[model samples]
Target: MKNKPQYAIESVDHALHLATLLQQEGPLRVSEAADRLGVSRSTAHRLLSMLVYRDFAEQGGDRRYQAGPVLRAAGTSGAPVALLRRVALPHMQQLVARVRETANLMVRVDASVRFVASVESDQVLRVGDRVGRVLPAHLASGGKALLAALPPHELAELYPDPEAAGVNLPKLRRELGLVRKRGFAINDQLTETGLTALGMVIPEPDGRPFAALSIAMPAVRFDRDLLSTWVSALSTAVTATDRDLAAAPVLGQSRGS
Candidate 1:
């Protein structure tokens, strides 16, 4: 192993160390990164911010950081994510056009959902691109849809210690039940105060939920009367995207953006 040089720059060392940790550990919260780096939370945040600016890291909706495009591009695991993002973009764009609302694609990673791809709407007050954002699987619309696809045993395992995890198991179960019945999920001001989202799961060839698609708009623009129209359009886009994903040879394994 190489020894640290006497003249090494501390800030640069911390940033590079954080990048390595992100690539190896998947995602990290500011607190976690701070503790690992033996630095203040603010210092960790600044370092992570710098990494994000250079595309070496990305911030999630929950404020966690993960490996960004530059690092991802240098690794083998990025193949599926890159391909998934690429394959899903055209469909996301079409979905945006259909509803004039922002569209997002996300994949579940443990208890969190990562926004892998997002297409913004043309509206003046639309939800922005959420790519590289992470959110709780129980709170986000797309996440709930993916969660609803989990087998009972798997979901039960997800909340083995609900209280410790700050999860309301019963409430989540009811919401997931509704998602299963409706074939979609409605995150009505749940993820954010003024945002409403409708989400559906994109399937793997084996019919398991691989990822999810969502339409997000300002709550002010949402009307109950538009529910059917939104769902119909989302369903069409989901079907088309699903068909294309199934036909892609590079996507032989389950992948997410």
Candidate 2:
């Protein structure tokens, strides 16, 4: 049987345990954490605060502590995620050069998408770095691109009840269908007013990847007539990135750990 160390450091143990809980069980409230850790609410809060400071935990909109980038990145330690960022940066930079807009690399996180890398345009009106930001999968172009590639059963699993999740199933389905047909997706100020993005899946050979590439720009600068040109640039970057991912030592990683 496993045995605890005789000289165990209780506070260290508690903090580590809390981090483990956040990594494994998703979000947790202060009271819930106290209950799970067998400690008082204040102590639990302190531990969570420390974790947050270290980027191991984050406070969600609902005031629950969830896994932060350090805990959730590439679903492992810094190595795999660093590898992903390394492999995607060059292509992303090229995409930004071609489109003269911001470019982002993201992976699906259940009903959301997390921007892992972003290259901002030189233009003063361009979008900013989106790293570590999360947005609804149905609203973000990269998220929609990744979502469109999932199998139906997996899609249903991710969106059990679209209405309950604040998603319009009928409309989302139509958009995903179009993405499948055209090999890309679009977000015309859906996530933020005056912002628009075009995205395409970054293919992975082993399985469907919850990953994609996108180009974001100010709405006024988005030229509908240039849709083909933007898509072509993103498609080329996605292709090169995908080709590199195929032979990489590290496998593709996505959100939600």
Candidate 3:
């Protein structure tokens, strides 16, 4: 085996070590962190404060520190969602190759949708890579698919006042209804002018959709005649990805922790 590097960044390493402790042991006290890391109380306080600001740690009612939302999310890092992304990659590539369009896998985060994986079309005039880009859920095809899949109560929570400032509640409801009936979502120049995209939701084990697979292509090359074909291909790809995710080992579980 190759030798490990001798040099390491002390502060970054310390922060990560603290995060690991939180993940393994749940809540932690400043003194505990300090003793375990062999650092000063002041250093531990500063480190924990940084975690709080970054959403990885939180102060509880008793003023002790506990894992926050970000930390909990980290604990489940072996989450199936990561497997979903990995299994979806080949399907995304196949979708791009077959449909001559950019393919993406996306998930909703609060009011926005984030593209986690993408396969760009080979054509020079194709859409660019969408990975790491976030956009309004109401405007993207993938976002609409996931939003449509939400339960009524959850939907209400997500958009308490659709008519609230800068929002058009009625139109969004209508679009979501259409998505439910059609089993897919379509974006026609909504996110980007002259671009059209179609998306299909991928359901989790609980039957709630947390992600979607989508294809984006230029409007100039779009045709009503090929929509059915594109939808079929995309749906097949999404289904295969979902199945693989189910069969694959859970992220952390597979690592023999």
Candidate 4:
């Protein structure tokens, strides 16, 4: 008797599920992937092998799998920053034009702030920072704006070691209090000597902050009145940018999609 050939294979739903798992609880082992996906170890291995071959994921030294640079590049091609650049560039440019100070968009990652986009001010004493730079979240205006938005319990979780150098919970709480009261935060020579910055948070529709918009200038350039004006301008820019992002079809759908 002739035996029939088996041709069953995994579906796209399985692949998408595996991809989502890798995206969420990343750096998975074959056993871990199998358990999460409810598949056999060999099947998980085969799926991961295909994903690696396609550059969807990479295996690390510890034999765990994580999303590869290809996936990262693809995901960030139209990232929030990119969307912001398209939707909020004019507002950022306008802020820079009016204030003649460097305007930047930043997002918090762990205990640091990552500059996602920037537009340099047209002033002679410009600060000249760019995107992808990480700064201590405790020091920068944008960092404070982000930190001020986090829930107190989450903030405590983020800064667990109070005895560690540069970790001052009391000071941070005080700064955050001021930030919440004033609707903006300030960095006076905290990031770089002689530089000052003012920042405001860009809240989502639910009023949760996902990013910060800031303007950096020379400390000497801003007096108390000028600082107040800059803060107002920064707040305006953030509000306009938030509205623009809210109205953007691509960003609105992409976030939920």
Candidate 5:
């Protein structure tokens, strides 16, 4: 051991340290935390429980711990969505650079999805910035990726009256089923007249997805032969953002922003 900082509360330090790890690494097991902090497994469990109670951390279905809503609220910005935009921007930029196509980050909003951040490609014919755009969740690649994660009942709730919503329930179900099978979504001129997009959900530690990352390009430039390559690059970008969400330091705050 190098040295223990003087005047630091050991338990609090441990908790903060664990939070940092989760923010940077995505999720952590008790054993992992214990090893990292040089503490007993029981001690790590207690520290994590404290974080969970305070909403700074959340326990996922996999029994791993990750950054929670409190961290989003405590981030150095306004709301959780704003913080999400900030957290996902760098990854989006990198994705755009790699694919030479505009990359978008979006979140589900009831029956629709809202674009929070977009990085435009340098190509002259690339899709333009889509930030602030909203489209039906079933119509856009990013939106569909998020919607596809919802339970069947939830989708039913959203489209109880398909005619009023101008959506075909059976078709949407088929599309979502395909997304589930493939672990991603594709939009072939469903949203924009001549655009194509491929999207994958960015999962939270608990397995719930709060956002999706997508590549939007002109339909003419879309190559079916390169679909696998595009999906691989897009998935890598989402993974990077997920890691950032885990590593962000957002603790000790009340809900004002």
Candidate 6:
């Protein structure tokens, strides 16, 4: 057999790592960020300078850094779900206060569910959640609720392997069936032990669901009936938000060519 030429393996570059770090934790100083990334201070400064030139980060007094307005605008401009978050945060806060539990808004990004916004509960034993955390779709109540509203074929395409740990199709289908019947999904320590969650999907005007709302509580504090009540409240809030989104002006229409 003829020998084939070997292709060179590409190494991970500093610029890529720096970009990832900035995306994960913005408003970070060069020295502090360098310490986290295990790179030299000079190297981190250089990377920050490049990011500043590119309008990704802005240097403030005391050498602190914050995400530039351009970055924030880019995140929300053309994305409908991002706009949804901007509009839904107030309602989510109200719901969280009413239910006395942590509230979260999630959307499906590729094969994972990303938290767009969250309000932690005031209780001492609450789940500490934050935005930008991606969780496995199969194991999360928000993910299952969102998946329940997707088209069956699309759902199948997204989860080809039924036995995969995070994207199990069969399990998702069964859970989604239950969600469809009950109008919400429940997570009993599926993401973390002693943390329970209830979630419901918000459907668009065309009846397509692209996002979900969830409430998390300490398992010791809430039982099945209380969880169901929280789920009902979440569903009502999601419905009202969806109506408002459908009525509001589209965000990206003015900026496009």
Residue pairs in steric clash, candidate 2? none
Candidate achieving the largest lDDT: 1
lDDT (Cα, 0-100) at 194 in candidate 6? 84
**Clashing residue pairs, candidate 1?**
60-134, 61-134
Q: Can you tell me which runs of candidate 4 are displaced by over 4 Å?
A: 1-79, 254-257
CA lDDT for candidate 4 = 0.76
| Candidate 1 lDDT tens digits, 44-83 | 9999999999999998888789989987864222224545
Q: Tell me the tens digit of each residue's lDDT in model 5 across 45-135.
A: 9999999998889999999998888665432212266567778888888888888998988877778886766788898777876755668
What is candidate 2's TM-score against the reference? 0.69
The order by descending TM-score is 1, 2, 6, 4, 3, 5
lDDT of 2 by residue, 230-251 (tens): 9889889998887776567545
Candidate 5 TM-score, C-alpha based = 0.66
Give stretches of model 3 more than 4 Å off: 1-81, 251-257
- After aligning candidate 6 to the native by TM-score, how far in Å is the CA of 53 from where it should be? 9.3
Overall lDDT per candidate, in order of appearance: 0.83, 0.80, 0.79, 0.76, 0.80, 0.71
- Candidate 3 vs candidate 6: which has greater TM-score? 6
Number of clashes found in candidate 1: 2
**Best-first order by lDDT:** 1, 2, 5, 3, 4, 6
- Candidate 2, RMSD to the unseen true structure: 13.0
**What are the C-alpha RMSDs, in order, of all predicted structures?**
11.9, 13.0, 10.5, 15.3, 14.9, 11.6
Q: Which stretches of candidate 5 lie over 4 Å from their true place?
A: 1-79, 251-257
What lDDT tens digits, residue by residue, belong to model 3 across residues 63-168? 7898878867631322244456678898888888888898988878776786777788888778876654668888889999998988777877877777662458
Candidate 5 CA-lDDT value: 0.80
Better of 1 and 4 by TM-score: 1
For candidate 3, the per-residue lDDT at 162 reads 73
* Alpha-carbon shift of residue 110 in model 6 (angstroms): 1.9
Residue-level lDDT of model 6, residues 1-257, one tens digit each, is 01112452222345544554455445678887788558889978887787778887788887787666555553321236546777788889889889888898887765667777778778766776546667777678888887788889988887666666455566668879998999888888887778778888877655566688898887787676575677678977897887777666773232221
